[model samples]
Target chain A: MYSSVSKGFALLVLVLMNCIMFSAKAANGITVSTEINFSAQPQQCVTLHQGRDCFATILIQWQRPTSQTICLFHVNKKQATSKKQLMCWPESKAGQANIEFESSDNLTYQLRTQLDDRLLAETEIIVSWLHKNTRRRRWRLF
Target chain B: MFTKPINPNIINRLFIYSIVAIAFFIAATTHASPEEQSLTTHGNTPITKDAFEWQFMLDMALVNSPVMLTDVEQTELWDYVQLGLLFDISYKGFFLRTNSRRSSTILGGEELGYQITVQKDWQLDVILKAYIEGFDPIEILDDQNKDIPELVGLNNREYTSGIALRYSRYFENAIFYIDIASARASENEQGHSATGIIIDSFYSYLIPYRNWDIYLGAGLTYYEKALMDYYIGINADEVSSARPFHIADSTFRAQLEVYAQYPLSQSWSFNAGITQSFYSNSIKRSPIIDKNKLTQLMVGVLYVF
Candidate 1:
């Protein structure tokens, strides 16, 4: 009876650990938020060579449990001074915006409450490349 | 620009230096032979999706050049348009490419060739080339549109083809080429004797500013007895008092050229270049050759499809 009880306890611990791991995995692309949920359609942009500019059209969507005045912002995390408001919805439960992004680095989009400027949810767009920026050998045009 | 004729002593010194450079390259290649064997074992990189490609381009140029056929000293302005096609196909390490038109600044004017082997920065190729163009007797006209007496009775020397082996080294901002060929003149009624060896070498460097590519190049060409004789020598059958029979000896020619190119868009570009050639004594002394030197200037545009 004592051994059986110990085994049961171990199984219970294993189940709790798995639950915590899966919850973290679910939060990988999303920010835990009580007021709003936000996401972008394409999570990444790829270019031909490193250091080249990547252009992409991003669709940002957000929803909340109740109506609230919220604003959407485009942010460049590398440059702290680069944060611009894209659009704002007045007393709406959900909102969507299309943005044209041209950048060489990753960028972030933030959804915040306009009332007190409190952060609610955020998502990121990553940049990737196929080839390094080494000198390419031109076969002909010499 | 050559203000005065080059002295024979300077020519001899330059020739010696060129020989030394050639020897050095041969020796270096021999020393690297072992590495080449190992590299061959690795095979080529995996093929990519865009490995086969082709392009067609139309080129038109306005040219100003000195006429080299008669004793009369004259320069003429002319324009021409040429259709060019380039096909590039590569599988593994082997490649075949068309050379319908090369850069005006390059020493080798145009040739069709294929790569034989490549090791690191060095590549070897075999090409079919023509270094000289033939002219008809009627093509040589005086200012009055009359056939010049000097060329009236002479037979046409048809354009010839040669087989050449070329070795090249490439760098980030510079390139070097060396070619050795066995050339023969085309059969014609002139009964010309033609079969000889030719050697040519060129070195070019690029200087880029903004979106422009500016190139400066220098080259040397050596012509052996049979090739030189066929072009400049007056055959015994056609010998006259006015055109005495002449035997041409081996000769050398030196060239310097500069070219600049600017891209207007993805498929259009502008180019301009100037080339000057200095002939050696054997070539200058030919009765048909009026000037010991020649200069050509050209400006052109190209459209790619």
Candidate 2:
């Protein structure tokens, strides 16, 4: 019984270890071939403080579309109201855009390959007004 | 105007146990927002019963004093982290994945289990896993409380695979849970070659206010003879002048817990819990055992992405 249990435990631990290791090291390797980095500053809000303006600064960045001009679409998921607008066409291989919303909600953005609105890549960021706990601290006595 | 008052009886019990002892011992750790998942919704339905949903929780607790003092007993505080991940895929009431969702209040144990939900009422779980000792005897560096004779003869524990069955349910204002497990001894480990059984059950009520949330609970634990000896027994060879041979039989443990979380923002919250556990005479009689009751507390922040 002991031997069998030991073997089983070892096997189970091995499987869990594999899951953890793979999850840590898998698909995160993004190729330079395609990418879109979208982020928002003040990603969240918790107070009526932080200066009354409770909104987030949205950023949309992607590799410049080589074949044609690309347009950007901001999909508001909070209220289900999505809008499309021309962002940037590739004058160069790299492109960047910064936009801000005065409200707080979840937002998604898509980059299109051409003015015809061929979708290429999409990303999202959320700006919230919920109260947030403070950051944690770690110290070592030894 | 929203106000939720904690039951007076619970407050009295919390006071009786001096649960506020760890109220000031806050640690710097963070759990994400979903940890506040006191509400579960299915499809387009309004707030309904708790169902298996996608959940990711990371809970960290800094215990000020080590309770299970089996090894290197000089440590003043210990850190514990419990991570849970559950993803459910279902369509038309048929769950494609094993509903692996549970509320975590037990110290720490791993269960490779599957759940069966009963009409969104009771949840049952069956688990099979390689067994490891639940009692942890840690080794701390630069030890301070070294030379304590009662901390001697502490050996690494042995374990084998085990089977556990758990049942739990969420009520209107409280959650009820229970679990039982039987263990098989590892063949190579000598003192632990006996089979054992354990039973535990708890009930906790939730009180939600505008910004504060409280969970008060109480529970009982029973360790069968084989299980008690595996953990609390002292071998003849390990017996010394300071540590005598101690044999244990079935034992019982009673526990009271109070946990609270204050959300400062939608993304950040402060969480804390104090648990006091009392042991039976069988365990308290061990020569190496010094405390009959142990109290642990943890307070930290939470960050949700």
Candidate 3:
């Protein structure tokens, strides 16, 4: 009866730990030791014309000193009021994701703690253009 | 032996061919789209690499004083609604482009060409384009089948397309272009073809004002004897007392244009333009020529993709 009671206690502990991890409530369990470094490859998206939508496959990477649960949010600097959570990861030290991005304006990719929504690391995708007018030239040769 | 008669509306066939070329070129260029785009965006982005790009536009315009009429009998002012679908497709070093304008639409205004070289601010290209648009008298008559007195016996001038070498210089707010072309006309019913040499030059300046781009441009064209004679000259056998046999000489024509474009959305735009063309004495002296000057006004909406 004592062994069964010990097993039940262990099961309950495991369940509690899982709940704490998933619910992002491990605020006192572990602390970030060092700075979180985040970056995105192909940092700039370029279109042929100024008004065209720029498209690119962005490679997002982040590294932390210790394993921790965090989520990524995409924020458009033009519309600061709206922020979208792209993805979240279970306790991990380093992670990378490939995302297809298409937008007319610049976008910011941010990494933050899921528990307190504290900003950790952020990178920006700069949008640029080659020509001012979209291929519609006024060549009126009569 | 019976023979097929020549169609006076041969320019329509040429326009249709140009439309087909636009479609074919657009399809061909799209084959090198994103799949072939290199992902070497490391430091700085190189804008024009080995890329395939396309833009499709639908343009409609209300034109005043159409230039298609060559008759001396019709003196009343007439208005016309012109519609055109234009396309620009580029791949590697070649491009096919079309422009929709009031006077040029009678024969499809297309430039099929390959970019030979692009220097710091200069570009050179080899192109195939139609220099002169043909006119159909039947279509211009009061009725479809009725023949106008002035055009009863006049032979229709067939549109001419030719090889051209174009040189362009880009400036901060303007551009200058010069073209030298050897235009070739299709064989007539008499089994004879004509070739003419032409030199054209134009300058366009852009003015930016409150989300609108206004362009002021001027152009000059030098036509050779063969082209002028074939289109405007009257032949001996087909000449009457009213239209005596006459020969045309090489001439220069001048034109001025003011054009503006406003963007309504990311993919849509509105454009309006006015053009005035003045003929020289050489062109005015042609037996069939009616007017010394032509004026046109056009407004259009464009959707780009």
Candidate 4:
């Protein structure tokens, strides 16, 4: 009877230690941090001459934790139009991801990121025109 | 024999009347149309026709200007200012614009200022501003006696007069603006005199959401050394820790800022931005600058008349 009681006590201690270690590991597992960097490559400011095509390339960088898949969707906030959809898997060696959009219109855009159908982060970029009154129209009453 | 002693009752009546007149003037100026108020406070932006074009903003900022540094070799400096304000405003094409602010004190002193801008399409926009600043000098401590020395001299009051000229253009969902401005500073007896010229080239894109706008741009400012030092803390290190006087060489500054404005209503909005100054080498390497960091966060309100 004494031996059996001792054995039972040792089993309980081992189980409690394992539970604590497992809980500690679970608490620190799988955190995802996302960052978005907007770059107007080759140009800091886009100058749109009146009645001319002002072209610029927008480079986007999405950084995530190692070994996570990130899906990116971009939409023009002003025109309510979608630009492109990008899906990427970032490995430990390739800790960075990238996407690009070519735009000629003056608009603001939103970049959204998701992981396994879970929303991760969002950010915005604003592209402006150079000249005053390039494409503006006066309101006319009908 | 000719002059009679002024009556005490008459003097009191005159004082009361003066107070009432001043109060009336302030109240009238503070209550401006939404369009006129927004233009003055945040410079000028393109107006829209949707009857809902407007901006709202909140800002917190820190500024250091070394206007006075007596010893160029020693790292003593003076002149620092900080700001916090909430602003709101509205605009419609070129017809009407208004701006207003509720300001707070952080580093330097307390101030409240407002402006109005009126435009007629792409042709012309006129701006008028009235501002007042109160300052308390930063004090430095002495090692031996535990006494503090005032870094800023007397003359802690500032009155500002400002005017601006604006030209505008419109794109698909954005309005572009170019503004030329001049502001004069009236300082108290101990304060330094300053005149500033500001050239602002701004471009703002209207978001699909109602009353949301984003802007990015750069500015070039040329100011007298005294003005620059007083505002930018150029030679703060040369001032003596025991005394309050320092001299600074004239300086020029250029900065880049990216900001967004959101309007909560016709009369109120929020604005926030990040500004980084590209300082002149002389100013950047000055011994008086402790950290030599050039980044600032600007948050403020947009109040439309």
Candidate 5:
């Protein structure tokens, strides 16, 4: 009986030690994981004229490990506004998320992602306006 | 009636004399005007210009004043040394700028620095900075008041030197600017060094009604360490020893700041700013000693000639 009692106490101590070790490991664990993948389209060319507006759709793809939610945020220079959305579990897929932005002269766009207020990734895009066809022809002749 | 008829010539003579007397009185009054008009002709004209076309301003203000150190959490009370020089050329919107400062005892040792920038309607500014800093050790001997024997001296010496490039645009009453630059620094004894890239952009709006201007800005900084041994790599046998310094080996920093400037006169202005930094890597992981995550407050005066 005494042997069984001692064995039970030893098992309890072992479980406690394991619990402490796991917590410590979690606290100090430094892992480098790629959190977000972002891509945009036309995927190539966008054209607009000075004093006119144009639009393009941006597609973003993000992957989070295990159980985590990703928040995507975007800003446009020409429109001077920001948009954000949440990707929850089960519905989040490995595909392009569509976004739209208006183009002005020398328009630019920046996008970033966050998970629970922690920034994961960021990138920038630029768009320029094209001159009219007649103007282009005149310049070519000159 | 008969006596009066005989005196018509005399009456005409009296009327003529009266007319001459009136004309003399009018001429005398006009010629002898008040002394006020006479003084105006001889007195000095308004002093529109001075002998020296350009003036130099030398100013010294005790920075510990409450107005200068408004935010307690961001600002620490320490001895501050500031020096500045500005030259205004004859051409409009052309100037030369030089500024330097030294602040002591906040983190330990001193930060000595100088920068030169050119001023135009739009500023194309270039800045250079050099600093020698020493970190205080955590454990000090009671008798000697020196660092503990186990600590390495390489952890104390941090020398940083860098150049910055900035472009600015000025509006009628406001200014906007963007800056991008890179810096490299190393410690000789440890063979440890870091190279960093920084990009900052900001806008300042003039609030003329209160004689002050407000500024808002955001900045991003990236740092990568070329040598890891100086930061966190430990000797094979010293596994249990704690690394007293926490340096971010490779990290990203983002910050937002607000600032205000008030002009005291044409030659003197007061400036202040509060900045908060967000870190990607832990501050305790840095190789440098006693570095922590905190907001910073800076306030100083600008003297323009």
Candidate 6:
């Protein structure tokens, strides 16, 4: 069982590395981003004392290989006719929103780069929830 | 001006208000956690996410220091390489991590154990740790109190296992650490067993300037008498002919460490750290002690994935 698991792990790592490499290259030329992150998280209490008076947050951040203007929009099935643009060209690098369950129900998000009013590249993005955000622990030595 | 009478009730109410206010202040100033990051995917192939993370790291350094924490007098500098593997599997807020540290020395500094992380952000952890304690042979009665024999038969190294509680927090540029452990002798066939509690606290500050990072840290450590005696104390049976029955009490120690790193790129960095330690009087008064200060230096490169 362990052997098979190890093999699977190796394969997964190879794929992840390839994806990262491709992403880097794509960001440089005509690709959408060098790196990007779109996520949803429960609003966390930033204090020692904990409480459940928390909501949810949607955040998006991206980097360009070169300075190119991109536009991003957030829409939801509940408001099918509304096109809530989160960012415009140049300023569309990052955006965040505090939301509720109804706000995220069937939400649609997309990123596109434009050149002289012409769309050059476009991609739909899906934001997934992470169990928690991890902070790097300090290294210790004996 | 007329002086008002002291009202204890107002002071009491004011104190409660201040505490609540401070709690709110602390909560407001805290930073967002990054332990679990939500991922955004392009309309392409689905990315597979794993539940476990495994990393292999090697730390090689040149150090001229004592053979052991208690053996402070050894001034000979030796170069050593330390290789380590860190395997962490985390889900939700719970995690289990197994660490392997391998080194080359007569007094092995290798450790193999698993630590259960019950909580990360609040900085609480329960750990089981095992390590080798090294020692040097005691020389003949150099500072004779009267009539004492030269040391003959003595143990050189021992293994110890312990349950430790660790608390850590990284606030802005400084990190705080506190670890307390209760340990007992393990795998000792010579009827040499000891148990005691150990407490240590460290405060370290990080300074990042462009591509260079510097760190300065200070810590305090306390050891129970049982633990100190087993390492530095002399036994009754071993105190004959030319040796005297000597004992060591609980000891305290202080340390200062300075480290710096330069990131050459995203995957590679060069780092160096030096540390100095001062021993307590209880340990200094031990019969075999020759030096009170111990210094260590390490320089190496690190790679990350």
Q: Best-fitting candidate, measured by TM-score?
A: 3
On lDDT, the stronger of 1 and 6 is: 1
Per-residue alpha-carbon lDDT of candidate 3 for residues B46-125, written as tens digits (9 for 90 to 100) = 32422465555566665554442344232332234545566666676567677535234333466778877655477788
Candidate 6 lDDT over residue span B158-260, tens digit each = 5455677877676777878777888775434467888888787787887754335577888887878887788767777667554467798987778888877
How far residue B32's Cα lies from its native spot in candidate 5, in Å, is 54
Q: Score residue B4 of candidate 2 by CA lDDT.
A: 7
**Looking at model 3 chain B, which ten-residue stretch has the lowest summed lDDT?**
B1-10
Give stretches of model 2 more than 4 Å off.
Answer: A1-142, B1-53, B58-61, B68-110, B128-145, B159-161, B185-191
Which regions of candidate 6 are displaced past 4 Å? A1-136, B1-51, B68-121, B136-152, B240-242
TM-score of each: 0.57, 0.50, 0.64, 0.37, 0.37, 0.52
DockQ of each: 0.03, 0.06, 0.05, 0.02, 0.01, 0.04
Query: In angstroms, what RMSD does candidate 4 have relative to the true structure?
Result: 19.6
Q: Sorted on lDDT, highest at the top, how do the candidates line up?
A: 3, 1, 6, 2, 4, 5
Q: Which ranges of candidate 4 are over 4 A from the true structure? A: A1-142, B1-123, B130-135, B139-160, B205-213, B229-250, B260-272, B285-293, B298-305
Give the winner by TM-score: 2 or 5: 2
Worst 10 residues of 1 chain A by lDDT: A133-142
Q: B204, model 5: CA deviation in Å?
A: 3.7
- Per-model i-RMS in Å? 19.0, 15.8, 18.3, 23.7, 32.0, 11.3
Model 1 / residue A112 / CA error / Å? 16
Per-residue C-alpha lDDT of model 4 across residues B1-305, encoded as one tens digit per residue: 00001112223433543354345344544653333222332554543321222222233333222222222111222111222232222223222221211222111111112213224344445544432232333222121123223333422334444566656665666656655667666664564557665444445454432224555555544445544445434233425554334454555556656666554432345656675555455653433333322555545553433
Question: How much is the lDDT of residue B265 in candidate 3?
Answer: 49
Candidate 2 local Cα displacement, residue A25, angstroms = 43
lDDT of 3 at B248: 81
Model 4, position A98: C-alpha lDDT score: 39
Top candidate (DockQ): 2
Q: Order of candidates by TM-score, top first?
A: 3, 1, 6, 2, 4, 5
Of candidates 4 and 3, the better by DockQ: 3
TM-score of 1: 0.57
